[model samples]
Target: MTAPRQRTLFGLLPWPERQAVAEALRTETIGGIVLVGAAAVALIWSNTPWSEAYEQIRDFHFGIPALGLDLSVGHWTADGLLAVFFLVAGIELKRELVVGELRTPATAALPVIAAFCGMAVPAALYAVTAAAGGGSLDGWAVPMATDIAFALAVLAVISTHLPAALRAFLLTLAVVDDLGAILIIAVFFTSDLNLWALGGAFAGLVVFYGLQRFRVRGWWWYVPLGITIWALMYNSGIHATVAGVAMGLILRTTPDKGEGVSPGGRVSHLVHPFSAGVAVPLFALFAAGVSISGPALAEVFTSPEPLGVVIGLVAGKILGIFLGTYLAARFTKAELNPDLAWADVLGLSVLAGIGFTVALLIGELAFPGTEAGEHVKAAVLIASLTAAVLAAVLLRRRNTIYRRLYEEETLDADADGIPDIYQRTLAVGANN
Candidate 1:
């Protein structure tokens, strides 16, 4: 008797999980357009004749004196509103860890290794470039992120008949990337830690966890507790966004008996729109407004820090992700899905370089309130655009091939009175 064929990495997702992933990609597609549009507007407005007006608005400050929360408009968007974006990311990460792609070692190993290598190679590239130029190494983490929204949007624009497994692989890789970015923010970006406030934040997290454990309901309770934890975390001198992710991870991903959706799912659904549509775009509106003159553009390439960022995002990401995936498949029991070609993986790896949201955040944290920071932001835009264009060219070619294959398959299915793809999916599901 012949041995049964083993399931491959990036194999077909379960029907329900495939649907959920598709729904998320749809939402992120729209959000990504908005985000790019917002960044474009900021870039235009900042470089126009009325640039001073833009600065005046961004630098405008207000706050609650009692809370010690005075901040500029830019700071509010970056430090406050961006937390909501991270909250949604954290919830997604929790879901993946608890019951989705990352739940099993066999399923998770490929993406996990790929993500770590993706992060490591970029950081190493940045460090080497900066060191060669005698530049500061603080911005090492800036290129380690893959903006899922921007990446999915790019895929949606360039692809029509790409394998669903490729999309799933990208999603899982980006989720792991987000987790690494969150940890970098929490550990590397913090300053002047406050023990008392940190203790308070921990206590608030405990309460939040207890409520979930006891099956507490109502947004009212969570809203206040979440705010308190975020505030305490901010005062604790850790990045305040850590609080948002902490609360998100604390929420239960699995539904209770008789409940249709899990609390984490419901909360993510409710908050994701605001996070994507408003919070992230608003953050981009403020954060992306940098000088883009001829001299400023020259500085991005001449300056070691920004140059490192560009290299890290555009080149290091591709080498790291593709090599990692190849190594995993070659050495481990993991196998690439037969539906996907190595060329498809290469395209997806290039797509992974479109870092934006968390990349900009890290640029600011790395070189806070300085000219270098602005230059790094400009570099991120330049590198991301470059990567997007390259990935688009590659994926569009693969998409055409897949479209042709799809048409041929459909024709064959018509002759047989059933779809070959559906049969394959059913067979895979039964085997698994």
Candidate 2:
């Protein structure tokens, strides 16, 4: 973890985690850029005259079928590659709980409270809108997610001057949001419960846990066990990705002095790039190819389902997060990081509305094999773009101020009594 510069105005800020978070956010930004490009390509291909080719590629199947494992390429991307992504997410969740923001009750409350509102307000808004318009209410959870990578990427591009604490806040909130989304999938989205397969998945998870308890350090041993757990979970009528999360959560995160890294940290280091760089982009490519005709685009406004998703993501997320954060601080008597203003929080809250990946995943689950799912995907894209643009507009000037502050904080031009910023300003005035 990197220490924050001493000049930060936020007296209550946790500076120690700044470096680790910045690095993580950088990686996520890169992944997010790739994800966006992939989705763009998918959209172009799907909307072109060669749209059938896109469908053909997406629908192509290749897997062991005898054991009920045969699936389309898109399905494999959704179930398999996304399991890897969730494995990293699970590791992050454990890391935060153990050593990051969620380590303390006081430290955890702000983001937890914010994430609760972030999810709740959107769901409430979506449900009410859907019911009022007499649309199916299954897609309520679509707007309850926050795409951490996408949001971080937006911040990276548009708010370079924002305080590191703001990035940390957004990251923490997104992690909690992901946890909520995962729980929703496990609870509400599961199909038929296959007891035998579920039991087998649990048994595999137990063995994986036992390996870490006994200090087994080889990837060779853990990888096979993880695969078995994922496979069993897939057969168990629950999302297979939950197995990844289970495996990640159970891993040891505290490193020995001699070993130099915890099992979870070591694996996360090795796997995170793959998850962000390859798995997620591939999944995006497969999942984001929605062909929207002009009528369908118009339907997004009139139809309750897609309209609700857009409103829930665009308006509901920002409003909910801001209100939740304000209320939490008021109730808890905690002050906002002084370096950050309400504007910074508002920018981040809008960024949180970029609920691309998991939102689309939930859309699939919510309306599987239906045109409604396509509508949901389009709506998510539109909402995310709208949120990103709004965040950029909101944070633009703040970025310049932040940039100056960062320069002043980091600059040490001379070993004299005065700081470089003052010297530079004095020099500029003299020259003028």
TM-score of each: 0.91, 0.88
Per residue, candidate 2 scores C-alpha lDDT tens digits across 1-432 of 998867658654465675454355337667788889988998888999999999999999998764469889998989999999999889989999999998988888888989999999999999999999999999999999999988888888776556688899998998899999999999999999999999999998889988888898777998888888898899999998888888889987888778888999988887876787778889889888997789888878889999999999999999899999999898886566655667678878888999999998999899988988899899999999999898888778667655665566467545663545554434323422
Q: Provide the lowest-lDDT 10-residue window in model 2.
A: 423-432
306-413: candidate 1 lDDT, tens digit per residue: 999999999999999999999999999887776677888889889999989999999999999999999999999999999999999999988877676667667777
Where does candidate 1 stray beyond 4 Å?
A: 1-26, 421-432
lDDT of 1 at 379: 95
Off by over 4 Å in 2: 1-26, 404-432
Candidate that would win on lDDT: 1
> Would you list the clashing residue pairs of candidate 2?
2-19
On TM-score, the candidate that comes out on top is: 1
Q: What alpha-carbon RMSD in Å does predicted model 2 have with respect to the real structure? A: 10.3
CA lDDT of each candidate?
Answer: 0.89, 0.86
Report the poorest 10 consecutive residues by lDDT, candidate 1.
423-432
